[model samples]
Target: MDIIDNLNAVKRGKLSRRAFNRSLLAAGVGLFSAPLLPRKALAAEGDHPTFFTWGGFDIGELYQPYEAANGALPNFSIFGGTEEALTKMRGGFVVDAAHPCNVGLKRWVDSGLFQPVDTSRLANWGDVMPELVAMQGNDNGAGSPWMVPFDWGGTSITYRTDIFELEGEESWDMLWDERYAGRLGSLASGGDAWWCGAIKAGVDFKDIATDMAFEKIAAELRAQRPLIRVYTDDTTTLEQALASGEMAAAMTWNSSAVLLQSEEVPVKFAKPKEGQLTWVCGIMIHKDAPNLEKTYEMIDAMLSVETGKFMINDYGYGHSNLKAFDEFDEDTLKSLGLSKNPAAILDEGHFMIPQSQDWESRMNETFELVKAGF
Candidate 1:
């Protein structure tokens, strides 16, 4: 099928997103795996700017102001992971803006594919978290910001509360528990799973890619292989598996729990004793983007309080805007496993740090081997 046909298939639910992504992966196109919202509004053919992002962010709500001004939501193409998106962009796929996490900020910026963002243009700049604004590589060598920190969340165990019995505070060990073997699931990307294994193996995050750390983390993951029934970047699949008792427990992000619970599935998002694996993903403008003004409008809209509220409450991810926290009471935040203060939560979690390209290549290759029973 053609590109438009494929997109139409996914939009209509006639195709499983994972299957479509796998086909794209086979064709050297990237897959988008993040939470996908059902289409809220579809614009006329080519009426909207294109946003290359994780699957679910194509919703019109986050870009309301942009749509209000331009008369349509941006067209979206999705990728399953940051690395996949980066690879596609490097291979010449262009969009107005792309979403990438801090772990990838430096590499994406250094590739010279993105232009720096002028903070002055973002009306919500003052309300953005300072730490995220100052994240490494967020600054161009010339001092302008290269990325706009947008959404934040943690990677941890999301288990069926009705199925799994806890012995103590929730832990990553629950994933490796023999009792749940064949019923456990995990994300496929080493970007997440390897770090999660590091936490379970007791490796310091700072030493995560070191030889000693790699050995320990590898051993832990090797042991975990047989326990996992599936390894995929498809959050929707994982959520369904958990709800249907196909997965008693799984390594998933906070959104999975929120989405599942919203559907009335009895689930719990755990604050693992070792700590949750945390990340902040944001938007970067393409250096050659055609719709520069509209892109800025879209970026600013995403940073607004309206978008922030949807991100935090509906999606269970933290918003970059501090004012977004005011929309939720402390009790509600706690119930969703979030802190009103993003910094405290970030400091407590095993936040992903920037790594060398060499390290990333090694980890990806090694993890694939480990998954293949090496």
Candidate 2:
């Protein structure tokens, strides 16, 4: 179980908050040195407030627009996981906001760890997409809403078309093909690898707790490890490897595939017959979040179609803004593989991480099994 789940259990009389927080710190996600008393913090007096999140997650694309519109640059501290992001927020720290994903949405909201964003304060809410707003959880009509869906994409295989003889054919079985031996790469994260393994084994994502199922995934991974160049989370590194011919294929974000195809890397994003894994990382306003007003403004700026166009033009994933799909002409869309019928494969994709603690623990253990080659 994660810290937030434990805290919820404490709220419902299953565990004590002291115990939860103690266990949380022991997990090495974060630590809060404080008197055991709860003290609520008021908003800080400032025009522009600091922003903190994982370095690559927040920067790179929208930095300039956000900074210019808000009159201050974001002050960032990279959190390695959603668990770590929550650990820092539990202490009422200073950053105005933090970014997590839709999977962690319910847990963050249930903890009272964040405030609902005021809709009226946002000029771009209407300009933003509907599904993205609905994803924010619930609307209270006035306060700060929970997390907002930011960038999104599928966890898919980007294979060299030259390696596969069949054209326009995509399937999970392609990765296990021996043609790319010593030239394939997979993400090192437990969450990503587990999802891929589950998909490959034909186990229904929600029904993935059985030992037989996970064992199959681990076995498959262990079998592939010898052929894998290395496990990495950095897509840029993967791109370099692919370009340099160090790896002929990689399991990467669909956007990475888009970037590669744009550069004419002989790569194509594929949704294998076994399906694909998708994810939408989110941005949420932390309760007692620093720079409450500025945080909303930044989010509003990001919600614009103009900004969405920039993201789609640069990244391969479908935009959080609905209108982004129409931003490009047919030829451009085909060139970038953006013309895909996303739903045809979405029914086959896996879910984000489980919100329950028991499931997360089991997932971590199952992941260890794969990593250790058990």
Candidate 3:
């Protein structure tokens, strides 16, 4: 389908925002080439708080409350990945609020570029999940969190069930199988690949910073390098590869399997025997926010049940609001690989631990070299 057809499908709920975005990229269309809202309704760009977030999240659906309160959505700046977002912010490209996941919580906080979110200003704070709020490095030492948890989900194998021959119960070894050497794919980001490597290498995340863990993980990645057909952060590439049977299996997030399933792709989001990498991502206000009050509103909107429902239903992600689960039955939640009690899924998965900046730099550098076949 063409980009216009894909976009119309998104508006009609026949396609997901992420899938539509992938279609746009495939058609060489920039995400911002068309405005999401009518030009007349939008406030002046500078009048609204800037929300720097991932591409799919810049949509107006997540900002309903913010729009209702201010008659316009927050200005948006899209980033391909969290690392890119952080690097841009560190370079003095400021936004009122930025989206970041739990693994980077400590490093982002230590950057001294963000401030703790005040829960009192958020109307939906009471309905927010305590387990998410209690994630490592979220506390601000004053009964508030550094980041207000938004979406949570797993990162694991999204393999073509029809093409991949399962020799045993699903395991992380699926990605390393020599039988599929030239047809496997993986995410390039060390934030994800390195953590998954630790799982595959039997290196405990608690000790991931240790020299032993680094060596083990690096060796595991290097061993798997030749097996990977591609290592990219773009979900579209992986999805397209899987759809065409060019790839047998790939590491992907929850939405990938969900999107593939919608298109009748015989795929499964694997619950590996070792474990899947899990994460919680949320919004953090900049310390020098230009529109401080609206920033709070933007965060509040994200935390609302309306936004939560969309996130849970459309994106197949677990929303931080407890009530968001009320909209789905147990079977429905199970199909999405989520549970009403999020701890059921989160606790069993290998939740990423916060790491020091030095450790992050070292891991990325080492992983890059390994990807280079060194």
In angstroms, the error of model 1 at 178 is 0.9
The candidate scoring highest on TM-score is 3
| Model 2, C-alpha of 358: deviation from truth (Å) | 3.2
In terms of TM-score, how similar is model 1 to the real structure? 0.87
Tell me each candidate's TM-score: 0.87, 0.76, 0.91
Give a tens-digit lDDT track for model 1, residues 256-301. 8876665566899998888999999999999988788777888988
Tens digits of lDDT, candidate 2, 17-100: 346544643463322212122222212235655555654434424544655664545556667777677767777565677777
Model 2 CA lDDT for position 200: 78
- What candidate 1 gets wrong by more than 4 Å, as runs, is 1-48
Q: Which pairs of residues have clashing backbones in candidate 2?
A: 96-290, 116-143, 116-144, 116-145, 117-144, 117-145, 171-272, 171-273, 172-272
* Per-residue lDDT of 348 in model 2: 54
| Local accuracy of candidate 3 as per-residue lDDT tens digits, 238-319 | 8878877889999989988877775567899999999899999999999999999888888889988898888887788899
